[model samples]
Target: MKNKIGILALLLLSQVCFSQLLTRKLIHGQVVNDSINVENVVVFNANSKTGTVTSSQGFFSINVRENDTLVFSGLQFKSKKYVYSDIKGIDLKIKLEIFTHQLSEVVVSNKNNIKPIQGSQSIVDKKYFDDEKSSSKNRTMMQVGGVENPMDFVRMYKDVFKILKKKYPKKTDFTTQTDFTEIVMKKIGYSFFTNKLKLNDDAIKLFLVYCENESKARMFSKSTTEFELMDFLIVKNMEFKKITAINK
Candidate 1:
């Protein structure tokens, strides 16, 4: 009987521990403007793991365990984060505070001085350009490893521009784009497995999401413009740009 009692206590303790274990989720809530809900607001945990976006009804949810912190954000509203303990259940009524970022003196100066470089418009990296052409590195990257110039690189960029221009006609400006004429180039590094690349899809997706959000903010938002998207792809590929010195 004593052994049976001990076993029961142990089982009960195990159940209690299980119940207390931390879990993550999507917490749902709404942002109302004149009694109408807004959608696509971001809600994420401090660790950036648990996250979700508001629906058309202005409701969002992210799963989180006890003591986790959640951030609520959107393009027009100031971001706010709160601890799980501060709110109970998924339903929440949040009042968004309007935010207008005042540029610091340094920022103002930099903005004025830093003319938009052609490639700086988007986050295009070399890999994205390569992947668009089936992940084959061409002259700039392949040439360094004693490999033949892969023509696919040019094809990839060409195809990317073609598609982007069709998708976003007004914003795309591939005509003024500079072709990467090979100077002295070298491989900074190589990866046998694509996942080994630090700035992979996971990182890029976040940028894409940000771009989407930024586009919706105003009558004319720049983030998701064709020029920007293509630029992002180019910038992403440039990570793999073989070190090259042009004899200009």
Candidate 2:
């Protein structure tokens, strides 16, 4: 009976200790002027792995301790972070402002009666334009060697920041989608493409056009490995042949 009593007492003591572990405080936040409780507001603790989403009533419960930073993100507003100590209460009333994007208007004219491309008002395939091409900054971040051209290095740095911003929260994406396609073309010069794929000048240009149209052009960056990029291009070459054959 004594042994049983002692074991029971120890177990009860352990339970009490476990329950007394880090104090849990409720952090309440509201989106001001939001008639409906904004649903799916992401609450993330940048300091730790603690995260949660707000409810339809614009209410969320998260287990947080003191000194934990909470970053709130939503589609309708700019992402904001609140440090637990910065605000002394469990409840936080937040106002989310809509983010605006300024874009130049594009007018499309069909003088050549080209097929209208999907996703944009362009009468012709938008791929010919450098900015219209899909680009990936992941390749830029993966670059290992040094860049001799100062301008290229600057562009690469810009791309890296754009990548980091897009990766977190994923609200935006970064593309080296300016006139940089020329830089890419110069990097993967005719000699490089000819030696790798054994293609003539005309064929290579056509291949480039195909890559742009297919949105596969971004894979060829200075940081891309020769073997991998070549493999991708070769496969795409075969697919391009099949496509051209069908069109003819």
Candidate 3:
């Protein structure tokens, strides 16, 4: 009985050690490539079943463990994954590559094996071909599209999006936050003041007004982690409440 109890305690200790394999890494991730900051990019980890989307500034943070697979998915770009072991650090930047699809046209000549449907009559699906954009995953189209001229296929695939832009108009207005002060304010959201800091409405209004003064705004920004930022706010929470007699 004494031996069994000792073994059980050892097993329990081992279980605890195994559970502590990963430290909750404070990650500041940016979704971008060499040129653009890709907002709305989905950052997911299948192993942990956890995920987050990039903010308008293309920023995100989540606790991830070692060996976790971080999948970066978005509508405009190809979905890519990076193992957490490969991304274990403060400088977490994910660069995304654009996706293009390839397709081929096969015209069957009744007599011979194949030829370009005789003269300039064109294929049967004229309108369809004009509007059709193939997907990269369409193996059937790729098989039919021919065993391929990759460069031509990529060029033609790109033209599909251009045609789409003409057919439908979308707002492309993009502006980055140039003012460092404004960038700081956006990082610490309004909810943090009410919920985390527990500041009253009147005090919150005054603090927001105070942030515009430059010195106070220095505490918040993209570089600051959420926990560290919250700590700073907690200090401010005490200071501001005291100065206004609200703490009394």
Candidate 4:
């Protein structure tokens, strides 16, 4: 009995040491950008939920582990993510792309051929002015007429509601959160969870629940692209695997 107890204690000690070795460690990293202002750029480790900000020189340090996802976000730069794996050295260098805004095309045209009016004289035709005034008055009269009957107002409301419902279905109406999750699962396919992530059926369901609780994964159903959803799943998978290993 004494020998068996000693072996069990040794096994437990080894497991504890192994778990500690797998834990995250502080890593020094730098953000590379072409622009001069790199200050205050957020460097976040999604796995650990810890973050740091870059200095004026774009240097930052944060805790990270193998397969950890580091997200860089800032006002002036497009958001970027880096997975830490097979890194040889202690320092990491990540590059950021500057954000650019493209304005919609605007056309400046003198279609009316109307010059600036001199004193009381007008350059445009009097008939044109009269036509514009008559159209504006007609629109005002139509609005002022309003709905004649209470039933007519209700019918108009129902018609508008139907149009909105067809365009954008409410979550409580036809789809619940579970429905959204299932839709996403179908879109991504079962093979991805099993083949790429190496997750069993039960584990996949559990992982989805974990993501929903931790990262609000259901919110992705709103406006996320396939690429964006895949990126999120990849990062969440790394974190999920880390948590599972720790629990073991």
Best by TM-score: 4
* Per-residue lDDT of model 3, residues 18-53, tens digit only: 886755565777888766667766566567655666
Over 4 Å off in model 2, which ranges? 1-22, 33-37, 103-248
lDDT for each residue of candidate 1 in 1-248, tens digit (9 for 90 to 100): 99999999999999977786644554556775654356656665565443555666776555566688676666556567677753577666777776657766653363544555567524343443346566654545535555444466866887899998898868544333321111001112223113333445433333233333332222222223444434543443343221110100
State, as a TM-score between 0 and 1, how close model 3 is to the true structure. Answer: 0.35
Question: How many residue pairs clash (N, CA or C atoms closer than 3 angstroms) in each of the candidate models, in the order given?
Answer: 29, 0, 1, 0
- Backbone clash pairs for candidate 2 read none
Which candidate leads in lDDT?
Answer: 4
Q: Taking the tens digit of each residue's C-alpha lDDT, what string does model 4 give over 134-191?
A: 5545545555555633355665787798999999976563233444456567568788
What are the models' TM-scores?
0.38, 0.34, 0.35, 0.40
lDDT of each: 0.50, 0.59, 0.62, 0.69
Those runs of model 4 whose alpha carbons end farther than 4 Å from true positions after fitting are: 1-21, 104-248
Question: What lDDT score goes with residue 17 in model 4?
Answer: 84
By TM-score, is 1 or 3 better? 1
Model 2, position 67, has a per-residue lDDT of: 76
Better of 1 and 3 by lDDT: 3
Give the poorly placed runs of model 3, Cα more than 4 Å off.
Answer: 1-19, 101-248
RMSD per model, one decimal: 26.3, 26.4, 22.3, 17.9
In model 1, where is the ten-residue run with the lowest total lDDT? 179-188
- Which residue ranges in model 1 land beyond 4 Å of their true spot? 33-37, 101-248
Scored against the true structure, residue 39 in model 2 reaches a CA lDDT of 58
